[model samples]
Target: MSKSLLQQLREMTVVVADTGDIEAIEKAKPQDATTNPSLITTAAQMPQYQSIVDGVLLDAHKQLGDSATDKDVANLAFKHLAIEFGKKILAVIPGRVSTEVDARLSYDTEGTIKMAHDIIGLYEGAGISRKRILIKIASTWEGIRAAEQLEKEGIHCNLTLLFGLHQAIACAEAGVTLISPFVGRILDWYKKDTGKDYKGADDPGVQSVTKIYNYFKKFGYKTVVMGASFRNTGEITELAGCDLLTISPQLLGELDSTQGDLPRKLDPEKAKSLEIEKLTIDKATFDKMHEADRMAHDKLKEGIEGFSKALESLEQLLAKRLAELESRESKLVSAD
Candidate 1:
């Protein structure tokens, strides 16, 4: 019997589950679990998580009482809901959980920092240590600045939606705990741009991550790189020795079922030997390079907007659920 690809990959890399599905995470049993607004919204819709969703909304409503409007309850519920899911995920995974701050605050440095403090505080109030939580933020300049401050305060961060080397360098310089450079989305852009089939190392997404990984290792940056948003097992396989890879459960299943000789693709020692230039990568350099890289620029903006919409949808769901709960309580009182 051959060792599954997932088993082989795990030997060289730390596997993290990028999902909100508890059962999936349980089976995959990745070192860490990550949740974004999109994943959380999808999870909230499931019948099994009804109690979890209701519990969060109802508790927020109860705390606020009649003074809080539906929007207020929904807003409060939205904030606590992410933490509640994080707590549940923390229960099952021993490593950590990446719960994102509100995407609307992505470009707001002050707001981002405050939310990071609030998020970490919530986790701590629940008795979950700050060490076990990674407050995920977008990889915007403002977001990176916020992360830098948070890191000094012992709040770890995962700079997400990262695309170009500019973002990676900025994150490394910021002393961020981790970065989630999107792989699949980059592939999507290149495929549409060139209409050419790319596989293995030729994949633009894989290439981007390889570049960033090598840059980080070569320059001796403390920040760890985690390749994220993979489109297939091939992309995942191509970056085998990454510090971490947050894979979707569907892809994790593919890796688990397939048998193969998975080789280490990225190595720190190998990276150190490779000659790569280090950029100053301040705000001006970051903006210039970001503007030059069409793929990164487009993807970063699209990602933020998409997550923002997911958040909006979640608040709407919470509002509706809150109304349902309120109506039920009203009916019970009338009957009494």
Candidate 2:
């Protein structure tokens, strides 16, 4: 029997699951798993995870006491809930798990660093090693700086929501453990901008990741490039030799079912022969480059807003659930 595309890809690239669904992760058996606010929100809605949500809310209420405001409860609950989900996910995947900080802290370097520490501490308190977790932060300059500091302290970081070469280069300089350069989102932007249907290697998203992969390999940057947010299996196959690829369960299944001739599209040796220039980007240059690349600048802002909105939605969900729990407790007390 011929090997499926997914199997073929795995032989060359490390497959990571970009989901919070435990069942899905188990079924796919990915080496690692990544969770963002949106994925966490989706997971919280499932009946199986209701206990995890309720447990964190109860803990938050007890810790904050009766004087706590809804905001306090929600914020603390979110932190606990994210860690709880991460712990559960760690049990299934043999490798590390990527748990993100709040997107609103994307531009706050100090806040991001502190949150990274708090999250890692939580993991450590739970008997999970810090080495098994990747503190996922946005690819903003501030976030990259935070990752640089954290990376020095033996905490690995995953720079996410990355779009362009500038972001990739900055992350490489920061020595991030990994970078999730979004492939699907870039394609979406180009498609809407140009109104052209792109496919396979012609896809703007595929081309973007390929460029980053080649650049990284060319310069001998140790930072891992994990192409993320894939729109189709074609994009995945196009960058088969990436350091890692965090794929959605849907795309993983698609690749698993399809038998095909998967070829290596990226080669480090080829990158070395391309005669690429080494460029340095300070704060001023970084800002200028961002201003020049309208697509990356606009998309980075959109991605941050989307994640922030999802986090806000998660807060609201926790508030509602906490109220329901309080109401049930009040009813029991009245009966007593």
Candidate 3:
């Protein structure tokens, strides 16, 4: 029997499942898993996870007591809800699970730092070691600073919404644990801008990640490069030797079904041999490079807004569920 591409890819690079779908994670048996607000919102609606969702609402409602409205309880439950999904994912994946910090705090250094601590504390209180958790934050300068401080205190962070080399360099200089460069989203921007088809290594997204990976390896940065938001398996196969790749379940399924020669497209030793200029990543440099890269600027803002909206939608879902549960209990009490 020939090895699947996924199996071959795993032999060369760490494969992380990028989703909050626990059953899919369990079935895939990925080494690590990642979750974000949009994914959690989708997963919360899954019938299989209804109990988990309801449980969070109930806990938050009780904690806030009778004075809290459903909206207030829903707000409280939203944070805890992420931890619950993360815990379920952690139970299946042997390695770490990346639980995201609230996206709305992407630009607030203090808020990002504090939320990271609270998230870690939540996992710790639930008996999960911080070692097995990666607090994911946006790759804004402020968020990177937050990760830097959290790293000093021994909390690992995964800088996300990363699309440009400047953001990647800033994260590496921050001594962060990991970074998730948006591969498919970059491809999305280019295709929309140029109205051209991109496949395999020629894909701008794949090239972007490859550049970041080579840059990191060349400079001896320890921050792990995990290509994320893949649009297709071709983009994934093109980044065969990335430190890690967080793949969606749909793509994972496709890779599992396909078999072919998976060659190494990236290597640390090769990167070390290549001459790459080291760019300074100070605040001004980062801002300048970010501004020059229209794609990064637009995508970063768009990604943040999309995530913020997903979180809002999730809050509404929680509120509706809480009301239903509360009304049911009230009717029972009156009947008694």
TM-score of each: 0.99, 0.98, 0.99
Candidate 3, residue 45: the lDDT equals 96
Using lDDT as the measure, which candidate wins? 3
| Model 2 bad stretches (over 4 Å) | none
Residue-level lDDT tens digits of model 2 in 1-336 = 999999999999999999989999999999999999999999998999999999999999999999998678988999888899999999999999999989999999999999999999999999999999999999999999999999999999999999989999999988888999999999999999999999998999999998998888888999989999988898999999888999999999999999979999888889888878897877887888888999899999999999999999999999999889889999999999
lDDT of 2: 0.93
**Tens-digit per-residue lDDT, 1-336, candidate 1:** 899999999999999999988888898999999999999999999998899999999899889999999999999999998899899998999899999999999899999999999998888888989999999999999999999999999999999999999999999999999999999999999999999879999999999999999999998999999999999999999999999999999999999999979888999999999978778889999999999999999999999999999999999999999999999999999999
TM-score of 2: 0.98
Steric clash pairs (candidate 1): none
Shift of residue 291 alpha carbon in model 1, Å: 0.9
Model 1: CA > 4 A from native: none
Backbone atom clashes (below 3 Å) for every candidate: 0, 0, 0
Model 3 error, position 230 (Å): 0.6
What is the C-alpha lDDT profile of model 3 across 1-336, one tens digit per residue? Answer: 999999999999999998889999998899999999999999999999999999999999889999999999999999999999999988888999999999999999999988998999999999999999999999999999999999999999999999999999999999999999999999999999999999987999999999999999998999999999998999999999999999999999999999999999999999999989999899999999999999999999999999999999999999999999989999999999
Off by more than 4 A, model 3: none
Q: For model 2, which pairs clash?
A: none
Ranking by lDDT: 3, 1, 2
The global Cα lDDT (0 to 1) of model 3 is 0.95
